[model samples]
Target: MSESKPGFRPAMTWLHSWAGLVLGLLLMTIWWTGTLSVFDKEIDRWMQPETRIAAPEQRISADAIVERVLTERPDGTLSSLLIYLPEERVPFYEVHAEFENAESYRGRLHPGTGEELGDEVSLAASGFLYPMHYRLHSGAVGYIAVALATFMMMVLLVTGVVIHRKIFTDFFTFRANRKSRRSTLDLHNVTGTIFLPFHFLICLSGFAIFAGWYASIPLSFVQLADPENRAVELFYAADNDAYYSREAAGEPAEMLAMAPMVAQAETIWRDRYGVEAKADRIDVTHYGDANAVVEVRRHFPSNRTEAHRDSINFDGATGAVLTNFEASPLRKTRTWLEGFHQVRFDHWPIRWLYLVAGLSGCVLIGTGFLFWAASRRRKEAAQPFKVRLVDTIAVGSITGLVLATGAFLVVNRVLPLDAAALGIERAGLEVRCFFYVWLLTFVHAAIRKQRAWMEQCRAIAVLAVSAVALNWLTTGDHLLAAIGKDLWPIVGVDLSLLSTALIAALAAGRLRSKMRQVEEAAVATHRRDMGSPSGAAGTVANRAE
Candidate 1:
């Protein structure tokens, strides 16, 4: 076997294994967390019980919310504010207002409860968590990690295809109760093999998400212009919202009423696009000047969707049409791309599909970690404890993250809203709870035997189930109620959590049972070799002898 000689295929195999092993855990965390992030809004709904309002609550118009903000904080620079209209998925429109200063407060008022709606805005942990999968909080470092992990992922997919020669032939093969190596191989093959299409599409599209950064291998032409402008041109922004400076021709500024303006906007949208656009906010630029323009953007479908979408710009003085930025093929295409990558416009089916593919990616990376440990265990058994500790860390992070995320949802439902509101913001508190609990899981696993793996998995199972129950307790909204009310998202979220819990419970049970069987087999093998009747000291003495 000329060990010193380098071989072609062997070198490729080494490249594949090491590349995958190094980035495997990070990729798994990213994928798993990203999957949950699709339902981030629903998760927040489940978390903040007060956000759920009875059917009779007053409906606040987007114009009114804007007026209120302008009234109370006239000096505060409006960075961004989203007013969500009530719907089955999100039964209340959330008005999120942020000022220029980072120390500003954001509140989610009952879309119906207009002025002085003082409910504390809960931490959008799911919102924050989803983005962390790609761009973590550490500006450059976050993107760097995502960039490195993505590069490794692409390598893994390529090398994985290379190593598995019979990719299509073994697509449906799975052996659950076989030898450990065989079982691991089946896991690697089954999860990795079946989802090749999904893996390819998501990875390809994900790179496209940051196309301005990496897809530049071919777009050097654009780079020749300003490198930064290339990115801006791909994604667009308005020129400016500055008012046209001119004194109001103080003649009773005959202008369009709010209701009539909406009616006019709808007529314009329906005439051009054959559908009424959901008007979110109406902005009057240069309120009284001749250059004044009023813009109304559709707000009914969440900000993430692309349909029933249009924007109407009008002359403030004449109410005559200025411009329209909706229903255009080009605008719609951009909307679809943004919606596809973000799952912003997705219904339950596509959301679940994304979740499955994402989880499968996580599984694929997880198996790579197991394969690494299996390859190293024999050598590591002879080395110092630290070598084995690194192995434990790999296992701990992948499994512990699952456990922590499940626990965080459970806490979301159980923790008092007021507790989160005090001193620390609810969002920040929720994040702390997630990390602290996750940290605890790692600490427990590191100290306990490998058996801790099963214990922690069981904990995850319980926490997940608890999250479902907590949702019911807080919202009086069980899965049944959700379905009855046509709340597919609510039903989907709960059922998904329950399904995860059941899967964890089964996996943990199987793992524990198998570990017991392995321990028993070791005992029986020792007895046979020693030929001793005394099972305790006699067995030890035989091994010593």
Candidate 2:
């Protein structure tokens, strides 16, 4: 019964095992960061102390807020402005404005008093962790790498299912007390079997976010530079002309008040959808000119699971209706998918489930890496370099990655506001700290060998506790105080940090105990081998009888 002549499923098993081993670390990195991103806003509030203000009983009018912005730029000519109104996750008014004579401006404003919230001193989870999940913090190269990883993930998942024919049984099975390799594979199977659909959906939607563009249009340079496609001409003719873009009349016309137009658009959306809805953003083209137009877009209920492109264009100066845009069903389906991928809509329960499932994904990948190494360890004993390389990678990728993230959070609270030295700003310094710590973990793993895992876990515990303590010391928002002030997001972050610390400490203790047992067993074997002259010469003759 030589494994039934190694059929299609066996071939798939080979593919699944090898692919999982090679890409497992990358998938774990993406999944872990993505899990953190589920609570990104909460993390942001914890990182940026000034933004911890509770939501006002009633927010100040948007018009009044805009007035303050205009006052700040009295000397410069305003060109365009984009406003993000106060929301549940971010309890502040954020704005981006361009000036004809000055640099572009971006800032947050108080929800009640309309004062500036000042520049964010830290990149936090929203700025760095979330982007890292999608792009790995590099520009085009990172984007392409993410796309390729996502595609490979799909292949891995499908082949994994094919290899594990008893999916339902596998979902129910767990053997934590078995031999190390067997237990590791059991954990991998349970997680992969149960979260198959979720992992597949996340990957598909993520790939679609950018892959759709490549699949459909906009090889921009190719479209424009190549004589064959005339892509630029086709783009503007369709995408631009649809907006009915027009030149500024130079001779100005009195602009209509924007508040009323926004209200009207909201009302139209409410009536059309039979639900209270609000516009996501507005784009004003040719501002203050006769040909000016305002596009109010993405009028959907805040917590809607999906998205649609619902927009209305208006003659900006005269307040006359221009073109009303509603997405085609095909377009609606795609936007819905993109929105689903983002997890932007507010739902605490679903978000928690996503976090749990995402962590399970990490476990699945991590265990798969472990099982591959363990299965090959005995067979590859002759090649200690290869075996050591695999172990180093396993330790560095699993505990090492977690250790780096702990350092990142700790450093965020440790760095001072607007701190700059040697040309790196506070935010840049934070990023450098993350990569530097991450790189150090690999070096530490290679040098320390098997002991690196336990050491790194202990370090993670220390860093996690330090992050929580520093957050309290710097922001004066200890967990109990945050709870009293109804700052649940900050409280959640604090509690999560403490939990991570506890988990890391427990893992470290277990690893220490395991190492001691292995050491004791080796000592007993060495003593027995030394007690017999035959054993010494036998070791050279395979210890043969």
Please report the candidate that would top lDDT against the real structure.
2
Q: Scored by Cα lDDT, where does model 1 land?
A: 0.65
TM-score of decoy 2: 0.92
- Residue 490 lDDT (model 2): 84
lDDT of 1 by residue, 194-270 (tens): 88777765666566566554544345566576677746455432211212223435343544545566678767766
**The 10-residue segment with the lowest total lDDT in model 2:** 536-545
> lDDT per residue, candidate 2, 298-380, as tens digits?
63346688766677888888898788766667666767777777777778899889888999988988988887887667666
> Which residue pairs in candidate 2 have backbone atoms (N, alpha carbon, C) closer than 3 angstroms, thus clashing?
none
List runs of model 1 lying over 4 Å from the truth.
1-8, 53-60, 67-88, 96-106, 109-118, 212-323, 326-335, 384-387, 420-423, 479-488, 528-545
Clash pairs, candidate 1, are 84-93, 123-427, 278-298, 278-299
- Alpha-carbon local distance difference test for all models: 0.65, 0.80
